[model samples]
Target: MTTPNQVFEHHELLYVNSNNQPVYEDAMPGVPGIDVQPLFLDPHNGVWVLKVWFHPGVILPRHFHTGAVHMFTISGHWEYVEYPNDPQTDGCYLYEPGGSIHQFMTPETNTKPTETLMVVHGANINFDDDGNYVGILDASEIMVMLDNLIQERGLEPANYITPPQPDHNTKVRNLK
Candidate 1:
């Protein structure tokens, strides 16, 4: 009669408090004034959850997702080139299907920066105007990039920012 939620006293739950996560400034290269906080990252599975902050007037290059992407806007406003009819403002939720191509930007009219929580399942492939391949970005690639940046700055990489290590000691608990 043990359920997935049942755990022994020695087991620690997989929980990450929003306040406990460290925020990194200028996380995306070539994109100044953008901040990122890793909410969850599974390098092995190529999935990730991140809290991204976009300064007003920031515009990202056109890109397409290999897998679906879910985003929840916490503050400010933003829009996509492809989804011009649906702009995501504060308290808005957006789900972009795989292979959807668009340019993301925080409207210049926005007085405040935009903050969003995003769960991405696959790589974001950048493309040129002529549809030429440029680059790919995924959870694994982002982790490696961040790690390298930390190393170059002489700062220790926070391993916990990545996926939580599997606990081998977990055992099914039966409460009858």
Candidate 2:
């Protein structure tokens, strides 16, 4: 409905100053000894970004990824139980392809918690040590859980960003 000369409005950039976001300790149900700070959520594309701090000696459930994941270690150390010799330490970047399965754990010997920033696409299908399916976690689920936890605990609201929804007025411009 616009002429060739018409100028379209540009979408504003979204930002999350993670320092303003509250870290929820043991926020994820059934996952203890970890603190989470959601930085962004894209429910439409099943993507979520988080900054997680894992206390020493904590072991996360084994999980399979439905989509790829990128994790960058910020501090301390952690490793998959299956790969004890390949520890992920400060500044380490790890990428997991879709369908990759692993159990995450922080060694009991660590004096401090391990922190990492993770960008996850799609859901994680979790399983117990016996290989029994436990649960699934995705962007929508995390969004809901964080919201609830913030309200229940009277904590500061998380500073996370979500894309603006497309509607009839949405326009796409091809810029070469």
Candidate 3:
């Protein structure tokens, strides 16, 4: 992010919001936070790699990405909707993508808490092109569901605290 043309390095550590609360939960006494850190922002490629952390029993509201959403579960018990290509074929997966619209939930796993690393490209940037909305080809079709997803966007957190831990680089999911 130094310069638009400068080479991006992986060493620079960026800690995104890990502890965030919904507007409605502000008055609550106890509440966990969801934080995200953008590790890489390559202007040259218009790409972003972010590390997302959710406290135990954290449930994320339903939402769709403006751009391609890529994710890899580092550890813990991560769960999501039924992806078209479910690895287990049991209709359960943490890495949900391909514009699948569904409410997602992350629960306490016997393993370490789940840490997801994701790459979302061209999310809010159209610096080049005619500011074209490349998130989806036809906004008309997807726009219909946008309202519902936006309504479910603000989800209150359950009162709880999960200590932050080193971002152990676990294997990322292979999304073709």
Candidate 4:
């Protein structure tokens, strides 16, 4: 069973965009200060929901996430970067995707502001070895690419792919 209601459980059909009015607005990328928006894509439990917004030395550059990415900071203090070959330290610390590194950061100040509301079940993204498809980060090399993407994907019952707090909120009010 794929789980999300057993892989969407057939199709009696509900409603995709029946005036939900948003196929995708800020589909995440204009860059200036960083704001990702892809409100929903459930299509019967495939799962897509995203809403990340950052501003404050924004460096969500070194990308990664083809699938299974989940996060939730929702208010300030989300530096969360990685990549410590250790050069006097300072990359990022609380990113928490299997322990850190699927690249996304925001925290400038509206009182130390940064927000992350995520649920990514896509897959096959591993950008940034400086090949430069789109790895243009500054803040400590985006924390060594967020500590090399959480030490190249760490997991051992330690929130395997960042799963510690669920149900902080869930309101998904009909997204298109």
Candidate 5:
């Protein structure tokens, strides 16, 4: 029979109250009117989850995703420059497969900022209007950016969740 002690051993769950977390204004340097609240970050697997707010008239640079991305629109509206007719509004969920490329923008006519919860894997390769490579955004990059922003703005540290380090014998299995 299995011992009681072995059966009772369990991992602790991580919980985050987003309201208690600090939002970084102008989170992306040079990108005004954008705010971000990091929820979770797993640098080892290049995964990050964020609550992002985009003010009206904001236009993100064109980018290509090297991994799939899932986004849920919580408020307001926004659309991809390549698909103006397919605007993502409140309560909308969008799934973009890896290799997808698009430019994000919020209409100037919007009365309020658009908010979305995004779960991203891998990196976003950004490009300028002329298609010139600009930079890459990933979990590791975000960690650095967020850290710097916190220090520069003199804000409290963010309360984002991160996985615990694995032991030497730990092995991650690919379910797929």
Candidate 6:
């Protein structure tokens, strides 16, 4: 018989109260009008979950994800440059496979900012017009950068954004 202590000890779970999370302004440096609130990050596994806000009329330059990305629009709307006609409005969901390149923007026509929840498995490789490797937004790297930003700005780090404990372990749950 399984002991009481083992009944619910198989998996590592995390809950994020976005309302309590700190909204970092211009989280992606050089990317204007963009803010981010990290929900969860597994640096060792290159996984990240974040809430991103894009101000109206804001545009994200061309870039590609090194891993699959799942995005769910929480408010407002946005569209890719390649298919501006097809917009992802609030409540919509999107799954972009790794290696797909695209640029997104919140059209000036949008009356409010766009907010989305994104779960990514790897880094975002940003490229220049000449197709040169310009920069990367890896989850692990972002964590370090954000830590520094918080220290430099004299802001407290959000609990959810903190690194995982050394003893933390993950296990799969069987829903039978």
Record all residue pairs in model 2 with backbone atoms less than 3 Å apart, i.e. clashing: none
State each model's CA lDDT, in order.
Answer: 0.82, 0.91, 0.42, 0.42, 0.93, 0.84
Q: Model 5 segments beyond 4 Å from truth?
A: 1-11, 170-176
Please name the candidate that would achieve the greatest lDDT relative to the true structure.
5
TM-scores for the candidates: 0.81, 0.87, 0.40, 0.25, 0.89, 0.83
What would the per-residue lDDT of candidate 6 be over residues 16-122, giving only the tens digit for each residue?
A: 78888799887777778888888888787788888999998888768998899999999999999899788999899999999989888899888878999999989
- Worst window of 10 by summed lDDT in candidate 1: 156-165
Candidate 2 lDDT, 25-100, residue by residue in tens: 9988776889999888998899999999999999989999999999999999999999999999999999999999
RMSD of each: 4.4, 4.4, 15.8, 17.4, 4.8, 5.2
Q: Which scores greater on TM-score, model 1 or model 4? A: 1
In model 2, the Cα lDDT at residue 127 comes to 97
- How much is 15 displaced in model 2, in angstroms? 1.1
Model 6 residue runs over 4 Å out of place are: 1-13, 161-176
Let me know the TM-score candidate 5 reaches against the reference structure.
Answer: 0.89
Work out how many backbone clashes candidate 3 has: 6
Question: What is candidate 3's lDDT per residue for 37-107, written digit by digit as tens?
Answer: 43444443445565556556665444444456666666544555444233221222344344554434555
Separate clash counts for every candidate: 0, 0, 6, 15, 0, 0
In angstroms, how far off is 1's CA in candidate 6?
A: 11
- How should the candidates be ordered by TM-score, best one leading? 5, 2, 6, 1, 3, 4
> Clashing residue pairs, candidate 3?
16-36, 16-37, 17-35, 17-36, 18-34, 18-35
Tell me the lDDT of model 5 at 4: 61
TM-score of model 6 vs. true structure: 0.83
- Model 5, position 160: C-alpha lDDT score: 94
Per-residue C-alpha lDDT of model 4 across residues 30-126, encoded as one tens digit per residue? 3555544444444233445545556566655566543455566656655435632311112222322432344444445445436566665543244
